[model samples]
Target: MLSTSARLLRLASLLQSRRHWPGAALADALDVEARTLRRDVERLRELGYPVEASSGVGGGYALGRGAALPPLMLDDDEAVALAIALRAASASVGGIEATSLQLMGKLDQLMPQRLRRRATALHAVTLSLRTGTPLVDAGLLSELATACRDGRALRFSYRKHAGETTARHVQPQRLANYGRRWYLIAWDIEREDWRSFRIDRIEGGLQLGDLFAPRPVPPDVAARLERGIAYAPFACRITLRLQGSLEELQAALPLWCGVIEPETTTHSLLRMGAETPEGLLAQVLMIDRAVEVVDADAVASDIGRILARMSSVFSRDGARVAP
Candidate 1:
């Protein structure tokens, strides 16, 4: 007999494989009693799988349409994903290479020739580097993803950049992966605006809430999240104009450092932030291109103060400061 978790997973797969399942047949297939099957179905529901159940004679459970079931895939894209994911697991995690390889071979044998070619060729070129990023809980990621597919609300404590944690109520819109980190772009129910939350920084367990009506998502969710990250709140936001087009600057600089926008055919605008004006100036000085500070309001004053301080230091101890 399969373990409880494994059985539940099998049940979900069986339910998704077909629209309707007879309760007795499903129970027999799993070699579990009818009571056990019922319990497993309920467990799937709690995990955000929209498992619909019908009671009485000739009734059973069905995995509702649109449920994001990653276990038993029936779609071609999903089959490709399963192959790639197994490969990634073999490369990144320890003690599972052999197991993953065996599973990959089995899945590949079952896949149609076209899909096998696509997944294998794609996996061949991509490199998976273990960068020592924070270990995000896969179960948490799965739950949140299911919530997004179901348009469910979520409540959890989110840690800020400053390390302060606060409660958040949100209607999740989408999950965006930028670089190695995962971010949730959601409508902040408390703040009544859209906000982005880093999945790694979300504390403890999530509290799944009632389903929310779908709202108009941004035309480009990844771009919106990029802007959110680029202009994140800081003591000072530094703006710089440089002699290059946006494309040129973006290719040269790391995305985490700042955002680049077009200004003209020959110029681009850089928007970045630092905790202090001096810190901001230090970052600005690192850029290779000649930059013109473009802060037009109060931030310009702070920049001036930093400039004045630097000038005084350079004059008082030119030899010591520069050399």
Candidate 2:
């Protein structure tokens, strides 16, 4: 039999691992009788863990929200994974570096020397390549995530790309990340349409409104987010008639790359936007197939320049023999 302290730690770990545990199942896992399990649960409660219990056939135990955070026990792999994630977050996520560092310090203090070395090595080897992307407030991201999960209405001030600010009431559905930026996909209550709000552009405080009847969100929230991003206004919009299966095009392009509509079994229409025509042409070339331009006038100059460059590089007079 495990000692009292060891058994209590084991029970606590099990409770934290899942949302709920049936009384009998928990007792069996702990190798203890019902009475002993009850005592262990009571002991955990006394230690500031809000362990809730229910009665009857479907009765189970759950760890509820407590007034203060409890010390969590993590296995070796979880510890390393969390450390690496925090390190990455410190680089990519805005406004939580200090908190992440403090947590990392605590984790390092608790971890054994071997695990600590492993985490340190992983952190040293990994790099985040994001540059110039706006940082989002971590607190706002957390608030938005919680509201989305709870189906709560949110009121906040939003700044548009043209620098116009307006108050928005929305039913937040999901938080999405693309191009190293965070976005909130929500139902705009006043506009009666779906909108993607940039987290960094959300101004002031987020006022939590009453619980809302959850609306039907897109089946693929990530794909929806990508479409919204791709279709947003840009300096240049390029359309191409690609000769390939829709499935093949989707597999080759990312969600944010463009929106592909099936024209036929062997052809698809691709609409993408980029700040520069050159960039758009480059993306089209990356498709690695001959594509007919739907709007040739828009990108004719870009195509001519690219073809000229390619011709110059492969000109017969430029061929050289190795000495």
Candidate 3:
């Protein structure tokens, strides 16, 4: 037999599972006497769940709408689904990592051993990855999502890649999450062009203006965001001319590493960015064979020292280093 609190929660769940229940049927479902069920209903009403009782031929009890949102219940499947979804939600929110750990533990404890093992494995792999540096303001993300849904025009100061801040008037269209970051694809009202703005770089809270009719979102939204995320927000732009097809180079490099273009049947252009010229060289050196660095001459003075250090390390031993 369930204790008083547990019985009350089960009773609440039963009341919520259907529109109405006959008094005797409800008592049978709860494994309690009719009087005990009435007391439980009264308890729920006192807790602000407005449970209405009807006593006639078709009489029973029904959960009526409350003035405010009262606590609802989730069955096992619903609980597991929500828990899994929350794991992938923004890890960038400050302090949520710890809260997330606590939530995961509580849920895991409630699960049967079979399910708990899977939950344990999931948390073990996800904790470190989920709780690092703070990126997106969860509240701000909600605001942007709301703006997109409401077709609202937004005014916010956006920080550019070069550390310059500019005011923007945008018709909020869509919010894109790519490469573990957030991007807003909207009509730039001032520039009169479509642009992808990284959400983290927005200066502050958005000042929402009057709602406007939504414009047609481009079919290639993800591609545009992929390009922006790959090439933008780096210290300097680096272009590498590699002797391979665009597809080959793309397969060889990470998705956010750079943007690739087909220069010809025999050659391709890879455009990427890094914080420094030497950092670009490091990425290039990752390729086994040599490739032409178009902007190499420009940064020759900067990369000379780096090349010398690398050469000294390799020239020390005639033997090849482990790949």
- The TM-score leader among the candidates is 2
Name model 3 segments beyond 4 Å from true. Answer: 1-85, 88-90, 95-106, 125-132, 232-236, 241-252, 262-269, 287-323
> Cα miss at 210, model 2 (Å)?
7.8
Measured over all alpha carbons after superposition, the RMSD of each candidate to the real structure, in angstroms, is 12.0, 4.5, 8.3
- The TM-score obtained by model 2 is 0.77
Candidate 1 ranges beyond 4 A from true positions:
1-135, 296-323
**Candidate 2 deviant stretches above 4 angstroms:** 127-130, 143-171, 203-214, 239-256, 260-270, 286-302, 309-323
Candidate 2 clashing pairs, residues 3+ apart or interchain: none
> Between candidates 1 and 2, which one is better according to lDDT?
2
lDDT of 1 at 157: 95
Count clashing pairs, candidate 2: 0
Preferred candidate (TM-score higher): 1 or 3: 3
Question: Which pairs in model 3 have colliding backbones?
Answer: none
> Which lDDT values do the candidates have, in the order given?
0.80, 0.85, 0.80
Q: Give the Cα RMSD of candidate 2.
A: 4.5
Per-residue lDDT of model 2, residues 1-323, tens digit only: 99999999999999999999999999999999999999999999999889999999889899999999877978889999999888877555777988989999999999999999999997687675746643887878899999999999999999987689999999998888876788999999999988899898899989999999889887777766666678556667777898888898888877666888789999998888777777777777777778887865766787788777766667658663333
Per-residue lDDT for 1-323 in model 3, tens only? 98999998899888889999999999999899998998999999889898998888999999998898767776866666767756766365544656776877777767777666654566567545435676787778888999999999999999988799999999989888765678889999888888999888998778989989879988877766776777666766777788889788878877656788889998988877777877777777776656777765556777788877776788676854444
